[model samples]
Target: MRTAYSVETVRGAERELMGRLPEGALMQRAAAGLAVACGELLGRVYGSRVVLLVGSGDNGGDALYAGARLARRGAGVVAVLLSPERAHQGGLAALRAAGGRVSDDALRDIGRADLVVDGIVGIGGRGGLRPEAAQLARAAWESARVVAVDLPSGVDADSGEVHGDAVRADATVTFGAYKPGLLIDPARERAGALRLVDIGLTLPEDAEMEALQHADVADLLPRPVPESDKYRRGVVGVVAGSARYPGAAVLAVAGALRGGAGAVRYVGPAAEAVLAHFPETLVHPGPPDKAGRVQAWVIGPGIGEEADALEEVLAAEVPVLVDADGLRFLSPQRTRERTAETLLTPHAGEAAALLGRGREEVEAARLASVRELAAQYGATVLLKGSTTLVAEADGPVRVNPTGTSWLATAGSGDVLSGVTGSLLAAGLPARDAGSVGAYLHGLAARRAAGPAGAPILASEVAAHLDAAWRDVTD
Candidate 1:
């Protein structure tokens, strides 16, 4: 599992780790890894010109010290000090001893450099980069390949917001652990490639955020035994679509069938359309409450005017996943009163409407928005977009890594809702179901798009989900 910690938690751990080690031991460990990564990026460290954007923080020290190591290896290294007086004296001295010189002309030095190291701001930085730092950053990006130390300068470490000008690095060398901003957007776009350098700090078991890899998803994936029967494996009830948008019902049922659930019971006016596409589904005409026994229920995907079903679905004591039109009819009080887990799947526009905020606001502040929605609704929230975020109140937010831009189709969200609801039926926790479903949903889109990078329909994503499951479990 790839995990991230908050700025405060990381700072506390850093303090604890530093107290046990020698005065400069931790810095040396970080610098050594930084120098090695820079060397690899440059290919030939000898004769390559490297520029360090030195600031008044430990990030500046790391860059300067790494520059000294490169200088010793015959690389022509120059340090551009943004704050010459407050810069790390020990690091500066080491650079001088190893034949690295400080330059006053930031633009010229950055333009000619083979690699530019961004040390202007650390994780604690806010309000983007300073004017002078931003100028140097722009210059470096225009000419040389830049490597950011820790996080890309100017992005919020906790919320992943780039309020102003920030560094656009070719790669970022992070120490200790990853930050939320590195994994999230629009700050995530600033960090091109990420490399974690272990400086040996024991972080808490409960991380602020996590990205599930194949192994993690596989572990959470439900499997069946030989003794398992249809009802024993679990049945997921879906209340979706109407006469106008019967395709939504079919697509939702398609995803549920392949979601490791033994059975799918669909309740809606689109039974004929759903049965025509997916005959395996147990279809009901209306009123989801009377739709037989089910371990879990998925409500609202193109239910448009049929919001009455939302109440019937909520009355069931089983875990429920509400999406699309269902989210519109939902209230915090409705979920707060329920004892079973409730998962809310909403796209940026829907989430924005729920909070009475603008769509752009929700899109820009996805991490914060997801957290707030989860807290307010008292449900696990899957905020779908270019990058999918799954959050639960008082739990580490899970960022889905396998998402592709191709999954941004009209009915893709309905498929995700069904898949996650099926996982809930299979007895996965609300948080795990949301994370795994998003992972599988994204992976299926990638597979459907193929290596040709062609466009795919929502139906193709549903079709390729079994392949995605194999890819994960294999």
Candidate 2:
């Protein structure tokens, strides 16, 4: 798994490591790694024109030290000091001793440079870049290949929020470990490719955020034992679709049938369509309560304002997954009163409605939004996007890394909801169910898209679940 720690945790770890080392050992280690990465990017370091955007913090010092290393190697290194008076004296002196020069014309130097290193702001910075820095950032982006030191300037390192103007780098070379923002969206979008430099600072096992790898998913997935029967394996009940949208039922059932669940019992108005497509499904044209025994329930894909079905499903004694129209009538009060485990799968627009905010607000601060929704509703939440996030009231947020952009098609959420509900029925906890389901769903989407990748249908993604499952287990 690829893990990320919170800023507070990272700081604590850094302090502990720094205390054990000599006065400037940690900075030198970081500078050496940074110089190596910069050298690799510029294949011929000698005679290469490198520009450094120097800030007042240690981040600027890192850039200055790295520039000095390159200058000693015959590179034309110039530091454009954002705060000359406050620049690291040790770093500044090292640059001068290495024959590197300080320049006031940042824009001009940036335009003519082979590469530009962004150190204008560090993890401690809260807001966007200042006017002078912002202009230099923009110019650097257009003129040369920009490499962000640690993280890009002007992005929230902990939350991945980019409020105003920010540096858009060609690549980011992080130190010791990756910050949460490096893996999340908005800020993640600005961070092109990512490289981690290990400075040997040991962190805790429990990170603020995590991305599941293939082996991790395999370990979490439920497998059938010799004594396991159809009923013992688990049964998933799906309450979805309407007369107007029978295809939603077909798609949802397709996903559930391939999940770890031994059987899929579908209850909805689209029973005829579901039976026609998946003859193995046990279909019932009635309410969720009268549908008979089920280990877990998945409600509202295309049920379109059907509050009665949603309420009945919510009141079930087992775990429940609510999606699409099922989220329309939901309230914090209603969700809090439920006795069973509940999971909410919401896209940005639906999440906005639930939070009483705008869609952009939810999309911009996805980590904050998911955590808030989980806390407010008192349930597990799976926020769908380019980077799918699963959050609960407590514990680290799980980020899915297996998704393809081609997964953005109609009925995709319906498939995810069914797959997650099936996992819940198979006896996984709500949090585990949501996280594991997202991992497989994204992997299936990638496999379905194929090597060259084509615009795939949601049904194609469902069909490829078995392949994804095998790849994980194998």
Candidate 3:
């Protein structure tokens, strides 16, 4: 798993590490890593034009020291000190000694530079950049491939929130540990490709957010034993679709069949369409109460305002997953009374409705929104977007790293709901089910989208779930 720490934790770790090292040891380590990354980006460091946007803190010192290293290697390096008087004196002396010079024409020099290093406003910076800094950032962006020091300037390091102008880098080379902003969206969008340089700092066991890697997913995945029969593997009951949109039932069944369920019992008005597509599905009419026994239930996905199905599934003694139109009928009082596990899947718009907030608010503050929804509804909540986040009332939030922009198609959520519900039925806890389901769903989407990543249909994504499952297990 790739873990992300908060700003406070990173600062605390840095301080603790610094206390045990020599005065300049930590900075030297950081500068060494920074210089190596810059050299790799430039390919040929000798004779290459490198511009450093030097600010007033240790971040600026890092850039200056790295510039000195590059200059000694025969690269023509220039540092545009945003704060001349406050620039690291030791770093400035070292740079001058190595043939690096401070420049006043930052824009002109930046325009022609092969690589630009952004060390302006470190991880502590908030809101937008100053006018001069913003102008320099823009110029660097237009001129060359910009690399951010710790994080892209002007973005909230903790919340991943960008209020106004922020430096958008081609790549970000973060040190020690990953920041929360580098994983979450909005700010994550500004951070292009992320590369972490280990300077050897010990972080806490618990991170603010965690993204599941392929190995992590492999461990969490459930496999059947030889003694396990169809009933022992667990059965998932799907309550979805209506006469209006029968395809929703077919799509939901498609996801459930490959979701590690022993069998899928589908109960709804679209029995005909589901049976036609997936003949193995055991179909029933009307409410979920008369659908016979099922280990878990997945409700709503084109069921319109079907309050009856929602109530029946909630009344069940097993885990239940509510999605799409079902989220509308879900109330705090109704969910709070349930003894069984409940998982709510909502997109930004649906999540906003549940929280009684605007869509923009939920999308902007996804971490907070997911946590609040999990707390308010007293259930596991999955917020779907560019980054799929799964949060429960108590555990650390799981961020999915395997998504593509092509996953924004319609009927995708229905497929996800079915897959997660099946996992829940297979005896995984709500949190694990949600996390594993999202990880597999994203991997399946990426695979289905192919190498070029052309637009793919929702059915294509569902069809590739078997390949995605094998990819993880193998």
Models 1 onward score TM values of 0.97, 0.96, 0.98
TM-score of 2: 0.96
lDDT scores in order: 0.93, 0.91, 0.90
TM-score (C-alpha) between model 3 and the true structure? 0.98
lDDT by residue for model 1 (132-209), tens:
889999999999999999998888999998898999999999999999989998888899899999999989999999
Question: What are the per-residue Cα lDDT tens digits for candidate 3 across 361-380?
Answer: 98888888999999999999
Candidate 2 regions off by >4 Å?
A: none
True-structure RMSD, every candidate:
1.3, 1.6, 1.2
- Itemize residue pairs with steric clashes in candidate 2: none
The TM-score, computed over Cα atoms with residue i paired to residue i, of candidate 1 is 0.97
Evaluate residue 296 in candidate 1 and report its C-alpha lDDT on the 0 to 100 scale: 98
Shift in Å, residue 307, candidate 2: 1.9
Candidate 3: regions farther than 4 A off: none
